[model samples]
Target: MTVRVGLTGGIASGKSSVSSILAELGAVVIDADALAREVVAKGTPGLDAVVAEFGDDVLGPDGELDRPAMGALVFADPGARRRLEAIIHPLVHRRSAELEAEAAPDAVVVHDIPLLAEVGRAGSFDAVVVVDAPVEVQVDRMERERGWSRAEAEARIAAQASRADRLALATYVVDNTGTLDDLRRRVTEVHAELAARA
Candidate 1:
C-alpha cells in the first residue's frame, strides 16, 4: 500500500526542510509549489489562460509570468486571488496525480503543499505532517530570508490559514524552532512512522 502524506506549514516555517529530509529518506516527494510554477511557466496553456484572464501585463519582459506583479495583485484582492486559484489549482492537481501514479506501490509519497489547510485538503492524505514555528520566528525568518519588511511578512502570514488551524489538522507536528540537525531528527522520526505504514 502507498502512504500518502500531506506536508504543510506557514510561510518560513521550514516545511521545505522537512520535505527535503523526507526525500532523502526514500519518500516520493511531490512538491505543489513546483507544480504551480511549472503549470504557469512561459510557453504553456496555463500561461495562456492566465494572460487571457489577467491580461498581458502579468507577464515579464522575458515573456515569463511576472510573479511579483501577480503576487501584488492577488494578495490585495480576494476575487483576483480566487480567479488565479481557479486557473492554477486544477492544473497542479492533474500534474500531482500524474506524479503520484508514478510512485511505487509501497512508497511513502509526501506531497509538500504549502496551503494544504487553507485549501481544505488535509483529509485527503493518509497522514498530515505540519511543520510549525512560533509567529515571531516565522516573521523573523521571513524578514531575514525573503528580505520582506515586518509589515510585508506579517501580511503574507495573515493571508494563510492560521497557525492554530494548521496544527489542528496534523497527524505529526515537527516543531521547527531549532537548528537544522533538530529538524532532521524530528522529520526522520515522522518518516519512519510513515514508512512503516507504507
Candidate 2:
C-alpha cells in the first residue's frame, strides 16, 4: 500500500526544504502550491472563476493572473481571500487526488500541503509531519532570504494558523530553527522511516 504523508508548516519554516529532501530520497511529492498555480493557469476553470470574481485588474498586461496584485488584495481583505480560496482549493484537491492515485503501490507519497491543518485534512494522510520554527526565525528567514519587507512577511504569517495549532495536529515534528544540514538530517531520518513503513 502507498503511504500517504501530509507535510505542512508555517511560512518559511523550511517545509519546502524538507519536502525537497523527501523527493530526492525517492518519495513521490505532490506539491500543493505547484498545483495551485497549475489549476489557475490561463484557460482553466479556476482562472475563469477568479477573473469573473475579481475582474481584469487582477490580470497582468499579458492576460495572466497578476499574482502580486491578487496577493496584496487578498492578504488585506479576508473576504476576497476566501473567495479566491473557494475557487482554487477544490481544484487543488482534485489534482492532488489524481497525483495520489498515480503513485506506485510501494511509493511513499508526501503531499506538501501548507494548509493541511487549516483545511482539516490531517486524517486523510497515514501520517502528518509538521516542519516547525519559531515565528521570529521565520520572519528573519523571509526577510533575509526572500527579500520580503517585515510587514509583508508578517502578513503572510498572519494568514495561517498559529504554530501551536499546527503542532497539535502533527504526528511528527521536525524543528527547522537550526542550520540547513540539521534540517536535512532530520528529513533524511524521516524519509528512511517512511520508506521502511512503505
Candidate 3:
C-alpha cells in the first residue's frame, strides 16, 4: 500500500528542507508549489483565468504571471486571495492526483504542500508531517534568506494558517527551531516511521 503523507509548514519554517530529506530517504515527493507554478504558466488556462480575474497588471512584460504584483494584491486583500485560490487549487489538485497515481504501489508518497492547513487538506492524507518553527524564527529567516523587511515577512506569515493550527493537524511534527543537523535527525526519524508504515 502507498502511504500518503501530507507535509506542510508556514513560510520560512524549513518545510522544504524536510521535503528534501524525505525525498533522499526514498519517498516519492510531489511538490504543490511547483505544480502551482506549472498550472499558471504563461500560456496556460490558469494564467488566463488569473488575468481575467485580476486584470492584465498581474502579468509581466514577457506575458508570464508577475508573481510579486499578484502577491502584493492578494496578500493585502483576503477576498482577492480566495478568488485566486479558487482558480488555482483545482488545477493543482488534479495534477497532484495524477502524479500520485503514477507512483509505485508501495511507494511512500509525500505531498509537500505549503498551504495544507490553510487549504484544509489534512484529512486527505494517511499521515501529516508538520515542520514547525516559532513566528520569530520565521520572521528572521525570511529577512535573512528572502530579503524581506520585517513587516513584509510578517504579512506573509500572517497570510498562512497559524503554527498552532498546523501542529494540530500533524501526525508527525518535526520541530525546526534548531541547527541543520537537528532538523535532519528529526526528519530522518519521521521518514523512518513513515517508511515502516509503508
Best by lDDT: 1
Instruction: Kindly report which residue pairs in candidate 1 clash with one another.
Output: none
Q: Which clashing pairs does model 3 show?
A: none
Off by over 4 Å in 3: none
What are the candidates' C-alpha RMSDs? 0.7, 1.2, 1.1
Q: Write candidate 1's Cα lDDT for 1-198 as tens digits.
A: 999999999999998889899999999999999999999999999999999999999999999999999999999999999999999999999999999999999999999999999899898999999999999999999899989899999988999999999999999999999899999998989999999998
- TM-score of candidate 3 on Cα atoms, chains taken together: 0.96
Which residue pairs clash in candidate 2? none
Across 56-113, the per-residue lDDT of candidate 3 in tens digits comes to: 9999999999998998899788899999999999999999999999999989999999
What number of backbone clashes does candidate 2 have, counting pairs of residues 3 or more apart or in separate chains? 0
- In model 2, which runs have C-alpha deviations exceeding 4 angstroms? none
Q: What would the per-residue lDDT of candidate 2 be over residues 10-105, giving only the tens digit for each residue?
A: 999999889988999999999999999999988888998999999989998887899999998997898999999999999999999999999999
Q: What is the C-alpha lDDT of each candidate?
A: 0.96, 0.92, 0.94
Q: Pick the candidate with the highest TM-score.
A: 1
Number of colliding residue pairs in model 1: 0
Ordering by lDDT: 1, 3, 2
Per-model TM-score versus the true fold: 0.98, 0.95, 0.96
